[model samples]
Target: MVIVFSFRKDPNALSPVNCWHLILSQCRQESRDHGALSEIYSNNITLRLSHINEDVARLSKKSKEIGVQMQEELLKVTGELQT
Candidate 1:
């Protein structure tokens, strides 16, 4: 949003059309920067999601192991009670 105008010591130098061109160039550069930032943000989100999926898979496997152990313990306790 900031437009910088550099001119010689002469007061009446550049025309309005030239100034507009400079402004347009600056806007184009800003737009390109915005696009690059968006791409970076999207890549970061994808990477985080991939890591989260890995963690979820690991936790799920651990949970299944615990469930099996608990079931075995429950069966052992039940048999002891019946005896």
Candidate 2:
């Protein structure tokens, strides 16, 4: 038996950190199930870890993009005021 799990990023969530914690909790519960014990659990854990990594990467990229945009806007405003 094989079980695969995929996680999607939610833009409206509080933050990736919180979402990752939620995922971890869910995975832990799933792992505790005694009905079946096989490679699926290991696979699921790996998948969850990968999802968390991807989420963190995406969040970091977005943060950097927003920071750059804000900096540019501030520079533009400062330039206009000086002129």
Location of the lowest summed lDDT over 10 successive residues in candidate 2: 33-42
Question: TM-score per candidate, in order?
Answer: 0.56, 0.50
lDDT top scorer: 1
TM-score of 1: 0.56
Q: lDDT of all the models against the reference?
A: 0.93, 0.87
Query: What lDDT does candidate 1 reach at residue 18?
Result: 75
Off by over 4 Å in 2: 1-41
Residue 55's C-alpha lDDT in candidate 1?
Answer: 100
Q: Model 1: which ten-residue window has the lowest total lDDT?
A: 7-16
* Tens digit per residue, CA lDDT, model 2, 1-83: 99988877777766879989899999988877643555666778789999999999999999999999999999999999999
